[model samples]
Target chain A: MAPQPKHLSGDKAAINEFLDQFDVFLLDCDGVLWSGDNLFPGTVETLELLRSKGKQVVFVTNNSTKSRADYQKKLTSMGIPSSVDEIFASAYSSAIYISRILKVPPPRNKVYVLGESGIETELKSEGIEFIGGTDPSYRRDITPEDYKGIADGSLLDDNVGIVLAGLDFHVNYLKLSHAYHYLARGAKFLATNTDSTLPSNHTFFPGAGSISIPLINMTGQQPTALGKPSQAMMDSIEGKFQFDRKRTCMVGDRLDTDIRFGIEGKLGGTLAVLTGVSKKEEWDAEGAPVIPAFYVEKLSDLMG
Target chain B: MAPQPKHLSGDKAAINEFLDQFDVFLLDCDGVLWSGDNLFPGTVETLELLRSKGKQVVFVTNNSTKSRADYQKKLTSMGIPSSVDEIFASAYSSAIYISRILKVPPPRNKVYVLGESGIETELKSEGIEFIGGTDPSYRRDITPEDYKGIADGSLLDDNVGIVLAGLDFHVNYLKLSHAYHYLARGAKFLATNTDSTLPSNHTFFPGAGSISIPLINMTGQQPTALGKPSQAMMDSIEGKFQFDRKRTCMVGDRLDTDIRFGIEGKLGGTLAVLTGVSKKEEWDAEGAPVIPAFYVEKLSDLMG
Candidate 1:
C-alpha cells in the first residue's frame, strides 16, 4: 500500500521534513544517483548535506558488472567522492555470501563464472579458481558456444562447486544451454539480481536478470539472488553500516526492486524519487504494495 | 484426478472396454497423435478403428503454427486420412472467433500477423486484409526488426485491427518491441496458445506461448489465447462436431493441456497416454485433481 503520488508534493519543506527523521541513507546508484555517466542533479550537495548533519550515507548498486574499486573510481571522476567501504555492489555481496556458504578452504573449489571481470577478480582474491568463456585480455564478448562447452563438461575436467551469473551483454544460446546443464547437474546457481530490464540511454535493454530466467526455468531451480531486495544484502548493509533498521531509510526510483527492498527490510522509511525509472502517472495507475514514506524530486532536498 | 497408470496394465481388451462407452474422441495432436514428425506408434490405426466403430474421431491440435490444410497434408502423408473439416488448428479457431467478435465481414479488416503463414493464409481466405509483413515465398527467416517496424508504425501505414502472435523461430527483439508498441496503442493482441514449450525432435523449444509473456508483462494487457485448454476452443469444437459433453471424451498424452482441457471443458472423460508428454511415473508421483478416466500406453491399446 504505497502512498499516493498526490500525497507526495514537490515542496522542499515537506521533502526535508521527511528526511530529517532518518539517521542513515541507503541509495541506489543507477536510476537514482545517475543514469549512466552523468550524475543526477543535486546528488552531491544532498550527500554533503546529509554528512554535514552527521547522518551516514552509503551507495548501493545492483550492477554486478563492475567491482567496488571501479565504482569508487567512477564516482570520484563524477565529482562524487566515495570510498571502497561506502560502495556495495551485488558482485561483492555474492562473492562474500557464496564463499561463506561453501566453507571450503580458499582456492579449493572451481567456480564457473558467467559474469564480468569483477566477479572473476573477486573469486581470485578469495583464492577460488574462476573459469569462464571470456578471455581476461578482452573480456567483452564470450560466444554462446564457449558457454555450451563449459556446461556440457567439455571445458571442466573436475566438478564445479558454483555457477555465478552476473551482468554480461554477449549472453546467448550456448551460454544459456551450458548454464542450464551445470545447474541441472547440482551446481549452485547464483544470480546477482532480478531486475529484468536496465535503463540504457533513452531505451531499455535486457539485463543480466532476464538472462538468468531461461536457465532457471529449464533447471526448475530458483537461484539464490545475492543482490538488493534480498534479505542477505540488507543484512550485509546493516551489519557493515551499524544502522538500526528502524532508523534507516532506502531511497530509490524503482518500485519493484528499490522500494521493495525498503519494505521487505522493514526500514524506517522508503523514499521514491521522481527523477528515474517510474513516472508519476504510471505509479498512480498501478499502485504497488510497498509504499514510500516520502517522495522527493531530488535527493538534494533532504535536510539535517 | 487423472486416472492412475497402474490401472493400465497394457491389456488391450481392458483398454478397449474402457473406451467403448465414449461416442466421440477429441484428440490433441502435438503430444498425443505425434511428437514432432513421427506419429506415436499405433495412433493412426487407433483413430481408424474408432471411426470404423462409428465413434467420431476429430483431430484437435492446439498448434496454431499450422493451418487445417497443412495438418491435413501432414496427417495424410503419415498414412492417416483426414479431411480439413475433421482437423481443427488453433489459427482457424482464432480467426473465426475473432472475426465474429469484431463483427467484421470475412477478410474486411487488415490483420497484422506475427505468426506462421498458415494463420495469414486462413485470414486471407476469409477475406481479411493481411497488413503487417507476409512472405508468400515461404521464407522462414524473418527478423524481429521487421516485426518491430510493423508494430512501431514504421513499416506499415494501414490501421491494424488485430495483431496475432504464433510460433516464429526467428522471433527477436524488434518483433517483440513492435508487438508491445502496437498492443499498447490499443491494437488487439491475440495469442495462439499458452503452452510454454513445444516439442522439438526429442527436446523442447520455447513456444509462442512463452514468447507472449514479455509482451504481456510490458503492456499489462491480457491477450485472448485462441488455442486448446481455452474455453473458446472447447466451445467451438463442441458446436462444430456436435459432441455431447456427457458422452464424449478427450484423449491425449499431455496432462496439463489434454486432461486439463477435458476437466475444464466438462467433457465426459480423459484418457492419458504414456506414449506422449506425460509418463506413468509422473502420473503416479503427483496426482491431478481432474483425473483422466483411463490410462493407456498407446492409442491402439483402445482398439482391442
Candidate 2:
C-alpha cells in the first residue's frame, strides 16, 4: 500500500512548513484553479500566496487547444495574472520540439497539423511552416476518389515532413485521412499530448490525445507525446527555467499527469487538490500507482 | 513455432481433395476475391467452382460502408453473382444484434450512428431507428457554446440508447463529441467491426475500427464488436444459414481477421491466399498466432 498524504486542511503549522519548503511551485490549471470557466474562490489568492512567499510559479497545462499567449490571455481574463514565458502548455512544448529540437529542414520542413488554432498559433510564433489546421481547403470531407489519390500519393503535399496532432475543435476525417497518408509516406508523427479527455464546464470531454487515436490505431505506432508526465516536456521545463528539483513542488488535481509528472521528475513534493479528476481514495488505495506528498480539500484551503 | 500449412499450388489431387472437404465456403471479399475495384482474373470462376460442387458460398466482409444489398450489387457488377442473404457484413451483424439481442425498449430505442449510410441502411432494413449518420444537421463543427450544452445534456437526444460506429467518410469531432456525450449518458457502445485497416485500391486505408478509436480512447471501454472474429457474428451466420461448423471452410487473405475468425469459430479449415493484407511470412514466424490449414498463391490456384 502507498503511504497516506498529510491532509493539511486546517493544519496551519504544516501548511506553513510546506509553503517554506519549495522555492518553485508548478501548478496545473483547469481543475486546480477552475472547473471549466468557474474559477474557485481564493484561487488567485492561492497563487498569490505562493508568489508572495517568493516562489517561482509555472502554470503547467496539457491543453493543446491554446498557445502560451492564448493561455496567458485566458489567465488574465480569469483575474489570474500570467505571462507567456511562465506558461508551459503542451502546444508550446511541441512547437519548441519541432523548431529547436527536431529541426526538420528545407523542402520537407513544413508540418501538417491535425489540431485547432492553438497549435497553429504556437507553430506560427516559433516561425514554423504548417498546413491543414483550420484551413478551409482541408475542411471538406474525403471522397471515394480521394482514397485512390491518397494511395497514389497524388492528393498529398510532399513537403510535409511532420504531422503535429493536438486538440482540434474542427477535427474531421478529411484532415485525418491526409495525415494518415503523410505518415504512411514517412512523415514523423508528433502529438502535443495524449491526455484522452479534456475537463471543462465541470465535465469531461474528448481531449487533444483523442484526436490522434485514429492515426495511432491505423498506423499501429504511437506519436511523440510532449505533455505532462512525459520526461521530454519536463526536460524542456527544467532547461527553460533552470529550477532546482529539490526545491520545486508540483500541485494539481490529477494524479496520472500532474502528480506523476512531479514524482517522476523527482521534485520536492506533490500536493493533490480535490476539485479535479482524482480523489484521496485513489492514492490511498492498496498498491496505488501514485501517492502525493500532501492533500488539500481545495486550493482555497491553503489560505487557512 | 506453429506448423506450416500445406502449399496447395500445382497439386491437382490435393486441391480437389480440399475442395471436397467443405459444404460451405466462407470467403473474405476485399483481399481474397478482389482488390478494390479491380477483380482478380478467376474470381467468378473460383466461386463457380465452389457452387458447381454444391458448396454454399457466403461473402463475409468487415466493410460497413455498404449494405448487404449494396455488396450484392457490387458482386453482380464484378460478374460474381451473389444473393443479399448470402452476405454477412459487419453492419448487418450490428443491426441484427441491436434489433434481436439487445432489443432496447422505446424512449431509449433509437440509436445514434457514427458511421456511413451502409450502417444506416442495415439499421433501416432491420426496422431499427437511428440518427446522426450522414445527417446534414450533424455535419457541422462544434462551437464553444456546444460544450456547455454537451455537459448539461441539453444538446443530446434523450432517446439515443446505442452508438453504432463503422467506417464513416464524414467522421468528424462533431459526431465523435456527441457520441462521447451519449456514451457518457449510458448509451450502449457498438462497433460494426474492429478491423484496424481497410484493404482498398491495392493499398491499406483506415478501416471501420478506426472510426471508433477516439471514442474507445475517451470512454476507456471497448465497444461490443459485431464484426469479424467476434463469436457473435459467427453465431449469427450459423443461425442464419444452419451450416455445420465442421463442414465449413474459411478463405481469406488476412491472418488477424479472416483466419482468426475461422480458427476461433472452430471452422473445418482456413485457407490463406497471397493477394491480400497478410503475407505467408506472418504465419511462418516463430510462435505465429495463427496458421491456416492450407495456402494458395491466389484464389485462382484452387483450379490446380
Clashes of each: 12, 0
Which candidate number maximizes lDDT? 2
Each candidate's DockQ score against the native complex?
0.09, 0.76
TM-score of 1: 0.73
Tens-place lDDT per residue, model 1, A1-304, is 4556423445666666666778888889876877766787788887888888888888888888778888888889888977898887888777776666545453435666777677766666556666663544323223544444543567553556678787655443344444655665667788877666555544444555655665565556778887878877887676567788888889898877888899899998888887777665556666445557677666655532
List per-prediction Cα lDDT, in the order shown. 0.69, 0.89
DockQ of 1: 0.09
For candidate 1, chain B by itself scores a TM value of 0.84
**In candidate 2, what are the lDDT values of residues A239-264, reduced to their tens digit?**
78999999998999989999999999
What is the C-alpha lDDT profile of model 1 across B191-274, one tens digit per residue?
A: 877666556535544566655655655556777887877777887676577788978888888777788888799887888877
Give the least accurate 10-residue stretch of model 2 chain B, judged by summed lDDT: B196-205
* Real contacts recovered, all predictions: 0.00, 0.75
